[model samples]
Target: MAEQMSRGSQEPIRNRFPTLFEVLSRKTVAPLDLYSFYIYMRDQQRAVDYLDFYLDVSQHLILCRAYVRRLHRSVFEDTPEIEKNSKRSSYILHDAGEGPSGEKGSIADQRLSAFLRSDHGSRAQSPQNSHGSGRSSPAGRERPPRPSFMTLDSPGDSSSPGHASSSENVPRREDLRGSAEKILYTYLLPGSEREIIIPQSILHDVQEAIEGPDQRSDPELFDSAKDYVFQAMERDAFPGFLQSKGLGNLVPQSMMFRLIIGLISVFGAVWASFILILRDKPRTTRCWLILPYTVGIYFIFTHQYMLDPILALLGYSEYTLFDFNRMREPFVIKTLRMRSMSMLLFFLLVTVATCCIFIFVPGKDL
Candidate 1:
């Protein structure tokens, strides 16, 4: 889709910054890219809560899909056959063991089992049953007959009025609906700790889909929500993200070191300038000052913006200082290191040259 859209446009896609969707959909943008963006939003922008909500919802949807698939397989494919065979075996055993005392014993056992089953069913269907308590039912306990409303053909179909009396499977559907509602209230609804800031129309759409009669989870709703989030970030947050100082927030050590080096270079430049100006010197001696002055000026300009144009002239037209800072490729890092070292070396050499001119070349005196 993105390729087709790019093709339809006059501008080459590569010349433009990629949207958040493009960045996320592409496999090449690793987790580190997202992490760096998260850090920037968290620390610099101070608006990371929406992103947090988006991530949580995304994870929840993935888990819900996996769980639904597993549930579908277990309920439709496995349970009925296993129950039929087990019941048939139990009936045969009871018939074989029928005798005077055995028959009486069997009757007593049936009564007790019926009572236990009824009690377990009531507990399982109770609204008051806690989430953890549902799992404590005995393993060997018989499951109630599969509800008529649930079918192999359409697992997501809503419960039919005819099967309303068979309340056994209703709890499972209710549990799914209730879980989804909980997530909605916790993240998307008003007063949530990390409420997502989306358009009211999108929020309404999400609420309607989740709260609808559909018994099964809706993957389309989640996909739409994710798309809206990506679009919102791309439209609103992306420009700020691009303009922000690259990965400085992510790698504070490197940023601090770079700042310190820049300060040293600026100081060296100023010191060299002052030394040349303060003493009245022959033009021959002053001519040597150009070297230190040039080195100092180069460092000052290239520290931020000037290097970009020079690199553009050298065929790296698309590269910016932001890209340089954010990229962790071996060559990029090596280039940055080399630039820093060169700055330091130039500073040292200029200092030594200034000292030489100060000592060796005598200043004019009356």
Candidate 2:
């Protein structure tokens, strides 16, 4: 029974992210395997950097499943139905009648009616229109008199610029509440039963693994970074936030790693250049020349896609890097496959160049 339950749980994970499952199944895979899993999640041979968009959708679905499970457990827990339905006196649903006693046609109601009739009669008795003093009001030209203490403007009225501007700036409580509801439904509530069966931990593990050892060691670091990102995004646009963070010395972990790699590569390139200039042999010189260019190209081409793993480290949603809607287009998938292939090729070239520069080139010079 335990084995069956484990298999049942694993099945949903396999179906949702087969690449990630396969990568996890491998014992010797690198941390980048997680990033690759997300990239190739939809494709066998290609993974665009933008494929990270599915990560967000997957997270949303996972959150939705959890919400469903929590709601189910909360609803079906041991509790009396009558007690659940009971309300405080303040929360009681009152009748729409005039008062608590259900009384109507009272003196107050009569007085209110009389006041409305008198006000209507006063409005209807206006003689001079707005044009001039002697100009008698035309039929239906009698305008409603403005109240002394207050004014009410129709929502659709365009005549009052100030009123329209002020109303536009006033946030609608219904809109704000409705937006909150829509976000909850879209990201944290399952529309169907299938989503509720899938586990979130597996996906989170994959994302964490790809992020790096730093993030995996301390998940709270990523949480803090995510909170910072969310706050920055709320205050301004994503691009602007990125710029501000950059100017403020808040460098991304991926960029830091890349910078470290770049500095090392620059040293290697300089060493190789010197070796090439001093070396007399043609074959040895060629090997030394290729090293710097290969390393530089590898870093340049892979930097964008590399940001995914970095963001994963920062606890940012993959949707920040890519959109799920693009996942459906065949052209986009093909382009991503091509890019992935190019990056792989560049990586292979860099590896070969490094090996040659260190091993073969030294041997030839000796």
Candidate 3:
């Protein structure tokens, strides 16, 4: 459907940004895929002739959804300190209420300008407060900060108070000079890669637009768009039948680590319980000792509290678990069933071992 729509409706995006589009075409990575769609959307908006055309293609919407996924990854990666620093500051001249004569405008002027901008100005005009809710009014409260996957070198300090404050709070940037030199020496110049820098602020706008699009306003488009997103994820997740061989290998390495921890906890608990059962201790006392271990293990495995510090280092939350939909994937279901079967087999083996010890061993007289 997307290919059909691409035939004659709009010029190929590749023609507009050839080198960058080429990288997008070849790479299935999240960053490049999303950045391409963002550029396409921006170009469509800017081109006066393309005003009648909007992104309606299935593939295009999938890319937009991929953008949302990458943004979530960034959020998961952010540290608490980074989150605090990235939050929108209320230090605008209006919030502080106008400086003296040569300073910022008066409170009345600030309010008046804000009103005018809300009513008539393009969202781009109010970059600091622009939202994608399709409303003219500014957001009541600032949302969490979103950092870009990549950024330019840090800007030098500015003498202006406002610039100083913003610089301090904004997302960090990479030092391109040193990195660029290495790339220039090692490989041919990736012209598109060099030119395709999307700042954290612009990425924020792209995120709002994707996540906050009103379904009721355009039901058909909304549903189709979401479906495309799901399809894209599923396609990437299950690229081939054989490649999807094992359950443990189905998810990323990070998720596999969690699964391993859960399995180990279950086995460890079973062994400990078997040992207690063999002991001559009173049943109530044994139960009390083992019960707390069971509860603690459950919490550690499910909540992943043990993984919190490691997840934080990667800019993700340990408590923020993966989407429930992932667990519903056919491969995931098969894997889980297999694990349960294995557990039953292990339990039977342990029980047999214990029975043999009881039957064959001679007991000492009390």
Candidate 4:
């Protein structure tokens, strides 16, 4: 549905962007897919390479979602009135598809003027945002299409020369990118999508996040997008699967490393107890002798004081409630530094156990 984005240019978006992908069902376009693309772009922070090429080639386009997926690249890349380094501003999306309804150029000028005045500080505005939810646009206005497999269905899928094939299982990157473009063009570009006006400071933080220390880190590309976009990502946290498939696989003998350590301690106590028994000493003291070691090992495994460091080493993101600006906070830094010691300790413990076995066991040679 279309209505006035401003005075006079109430034309439908399809006429302007004129891309068919704009009308596709949304199911084919997953939020995570879009988030990934956002992650890639936002990481660039300021570099949109080949700007004019995209702008010109995509002139007949609406703002596609973040990714480059399908055949439609039609969107009017109208020069935004936002100037360089406008610290405070909000993005206003206008349906370039809709021809100017008001006095020619007035609507675009109005949108630009608002962005310029705000210095990019205010909320990004879109026509959709102004329209209440579930409300239809006035007659003859264009609305975003729901994306679907049927739309992307190629000639191979349908035996129709102009259509898509039916047998493709997974979509390619181009497909994803095209779909993303359409989403952006229709839903996000103009005053259609929710205007997420992030503070410049926050944007800087996001840039810093992806661009690591020494300024080499990949930027957090997803920061500027819908919050729920990545809810489906199963981040590869530990590479534990690799370990489990190989050296890290925990059989019964090594199931819980803690349990293994306890078993070793118990064996030590049992051996010591046997020695006492052979010398005609009481057997009851054996369990008592082993109790401390069992308790100690149990606590160590449960608390994982050592493992935290290791996990951090394996690239865990860190956050803390404590403010450090006022105090030295050396302890906090120190603790963070030592987060990876668990992996080291596991090896060290193994070494210590080996030494003990060689020293204490009868007829054992190391």
The candidate that achieves the highest TM-score relative to the unseen native structure: 1
Model 3 C-alpha lDDT per residue in residues 37-77, reported as the tens digit of each score: 34322332232111111122222222222222332334445
Q: Tell me how candidate 4 scores on lDDT.
A: 0.30
- Listed per model in order, the count of residue pairs whose N, CA or C atoms clash below 3 Å is 0, 0, 4, 69
Off by over 4 Å in 1: 1-19, 29-32, 79-179, 208-217, 222-224, 239-268, 281-366
**Tens digits of per-residue lDDT for model 4, 99-196:** 24554443543343332223222322232422222344444232222332223323244322222222332222222223333334333333534222
Worst lDDT run of 10 residues, candidate 3, spans 171-180
lDDT of all predictions: 0.44, 0.34, 0.31, 0.30
* TM-score against truth, every candidate: 0.47, 0.25, 0.22, 0.22
Ranking by lDDT: 1, 2, 3, 4
lDDT (10s digit) by residue, model 2, range 1-366? 211223443322111212322432331122213432333322332222112222333222222222223323344454466655545321221211112464543332333223323323323222133222356445443222111111322224431222222433222212222222222222223452112112355434433432333212111212322333334333433233222221111123444565567667867776766565456456644565566655554554445454322232233322222431113212223334554566576677766766565545433343
Residue 120, model 1, lDDT: 36
Candidate 3 root-mean-square deviation in Å: 22.4
Residue pairs with colliding backbones in model 2 are: none
lDDT of 4 at 78: 33
lDDT of 1 by residue, 158-193 (tens): 332222223443324334334444456655777865
Greater-lDDT candidate between 3 and 4: 3
Best by lDDT: 1
